[model samples]
Target: MELGIFLLAAQFEAGDQGAVLTAALDAGCAAEVAGFGEAWIAEHHFVPYGVCPSAVTFAAMLLGRTDRLRVGTAISVLPNTHPVLLGEQTALLDQLSHGRFTLGIGRGGPWVDLEVFGGGLERYEEEGWAESVDLLMRWLTRRRVAADGPQYHFREVPVVPRPLTRPHPPVIVACTTPASAALAARQGLPMLLGMHADDTEKAEMIRTYDAAARACGRDPRGVPHAAAAVALVADSRTEAVRELRTALPKWLGLGLPAHQTLDGHPRTMRDPRTYTDYLCSIHPIGTPKECIARLRRTAEATGITRQLLFVEGAGTRERTLENIHRLGKEVLPHLQAD
Candidate 1:
């Protein structure tokens, strides 16, 4: 089992953005020293959901900071950027890292990302996501190619600075629906699933992906797929859950534009009891022992060997660091042993 840190780069504190970024970078370095295999950064714009606007730039910084940790974008939104530019930057990063970079691509949503970065809602609705991805893959793998897509068109051109990794670095897609999983399998690519999914959903998704891969003459079991979920490991379940109750609402509150608020108290800071209950029902939050049991069951049920632990969403700098240490030192070993 490989342990990966999902760096949210969350702006939990609105007062000091610089401190938040520094803490996130510090956590990345700490993760490398703590024996984590990979550190994945997320990209978000115009909100505190994630402060990092360019995951590629952050990945480059993290790769420079760490010696052994593999750095990847949790996802770099594809529809919003030019495939050729993305391919060029990714190739450069891969070369600099000595082939320690992985590319995770996705069509991000909640409607706003597309609305803002992707021109507008109308454009997003009519956009050809698959065609864009196909063009991207071509640009990454081939030396000379032309993009022939609804969104992009170009004459034959040579893409310079071929990736250090043969045939390009591993490319993974973030999958949420059955269609997305099938698309990944068809492309002979692995996937990244979210933590919100229950054991049953995870297993179902794996099955769906495997069947699709098989249909395409690809081996799904051999493909490396991973899942991410909120993680907060503490000395006691009470302490862990308490922290969760406080952090979750604030993070989820970014959905206020959709009229779906996590912490409804506009003036209040604390999350409501019902909100805490809802979070507990969805995420894996508890003491090390409890988290161990939960993770074990998830593995047993879903047969997933790789997981990205999300520790930065709702914790202070000290607490997040402590949880990461405990995860790598205590929780990881148990998971590996079992």
Candidate 2:
């Protein structure tokens, strides 16, 4: 099994944005030192849910800071950016990092981000996502690319500094719904399942994706799908859960209500306390032994080998780092042995 940290760079308090960012970067370096294989960065705009506005840019900085740890965007919102420009950046990062970059793409929500980026709500709701992803795939896989779609119409241009990895660097799709899972399957790309989902939900999504991949003549068994889950390790389950319940709710409370929809759509944010309770029940928040059991069960149920753990549920940088190190030293070996 491959273990990695998922860095949201969330601001749990009302101060020091730079400190939050520094902590995220420090965690990425710690992942490498602790013998983890990868670190994924999240992107959010105008929300403390994730202060990092550009996951790819953050990934580049972390790549520069670490020697062996692979860095990837948990997702870079596809509809809000030009595919060609993103492809160019992805290619450069992959080449420079010696094929250690993974580009995870997603159709972000109908948020104010589309309006701010001039993409509009229509782009988020319509064919823009498929068109953009298609163009991006062409850019990564071919020597030159062109596009003529409702969202993009362009002349053929040569791909400069092609990705260093054969074919291209790994591309994973963030799947939150059946449609998204199908989209990834049709493209024969792996899926990145979110932390909010349970094993049953994730297994169903994998089934949806697998059936779609088969329909498209793509084998799904070989695809290395990744699952994200909240993680914290302490002396006992009580201590771990108590710490997360207190800190995660505060982070969620400060961050969730900040999202604004682009088209005046009604958006109901999850209740922070309730959501925190749900996460503690479903995720790996306990001693190392209990964490290992939870993760192994999730993997066995979902057939997911890649684990992307959200280590910041404890809120503070010190506790987050301790969780990461404990996970790497105590839990990872047993899970990997399985």
Candidate 3:
């Protein structure tokens, strides 16, 4: 299994924005030096989770800072923008990063992005999302393209300055549900799970995603499955547990904004009241060995090859950096060895 760093990009009450991004990049630079595979960033508008709303733009900035570390968007909700423009932006990033770009797409969160953009949750339906993806792939690949569809459209125009990377950049999809996973499989797109599901559920979700691909007559191994997860690794289980407990409610606060659109539309109903049991059930947090055990068990149960760990959010930058270094030093090698 390959491990990657996923910064929560949560706002810091004490620091400047440049410092926040600089700290994140510094940590990512360290992770690359530590031998991680990818540095996955997420995108969200008007959300405090991490203001790097342009994961691709962030990746562009990080390109010159690191070598041998791939960068990807854990996801960019595509329904909010045009396919051609999205393709253009990512392709430029791919060129700038020397082909180290992977496009991750998903329908924006219902309670947050979708409602704000006037897009519906039902748009995540296999057919519609898949069609949008098809259109994206088409625009990314074919030089001369033409299309007139319900969700998206295009004309037979010559797309110049084609992607620097061959076959355009690889595409990934964030699969939150069984149906969405199935859609990813049928489309042969790699599926990336989110940080909200725990060990058992994440494992099951990956299996369903892989199975869906295979059922679509595609090679299961060809479709990669990755999960974004919250992690806390420490020298002692007691310390890990304590920190985990202290940070649980803060995690809810961090995520609620992503659920609430920029308009603060209350769409996603998550009871921040029962924060512990609910958050604990989903986030993977503990000592090195404990974290490794959950990771190993998840791999055995679901066959996930890669996962991005959410290492920053509601924690001091120093603490987040320390946890990430410790994770790379302790937990990663053990899991990879297994």
The TM-score leader among the candidates is 2
Model 3, 28-81: lDDT tens digits are 787787678888777878665566777777777667788788988767877766
The 10-residue segment of model 1 with minimum total lDDT is 256-265
Candidate 1 wrong stretches, greater than 4 Å = 110-112, 115-127, 254-279
Error of 3 at 283 (Å): 5.1
Query: Model 1, 1-338: lDDT tens per residue?
Result: 77788987887656687887888888998998788899999987677767888888889999999999998898998766777788889889888899999999887654456545653433233246676667778878888988665677789999888888878788899888888898899888888987667778888999999999999898877688888877788778787877777876766665223321223323333344565565566555787788778777777788887889888845588887887898888888877776
Q: After superposition, how far is residue 159 of candidate 2 from its true place, in Å?
A: 0.4
How much does candidate 2 score in TM-score? 0.98
Residue pairs that clash (backbone atoms under 3 angstroms), model 1: none
Better of 2 and 3 by lDDT: 2
From the highest TM-score down, the ranking of the candidates is 2, 1, 3
Which portions of model 2 miss their true places by more than 4 Å?
none
CA deviation > 4 Å runs, candidate 3 = 12-15, 111-128, 254-265, 273-284
How many clashes does each candidate structure show, in the order listed?
0, 0, 1
- Residue 17 displacement in candidate 3 (angstroms): 3.9
> lDDT per prediction?
0.78, 0.91, 0.73
Measured on C-alpha atoms, candidate 1 has an lDDT of: 0.78
Candidate 3: minimum summed lDDT over ten consecutive residues — where? 257-266
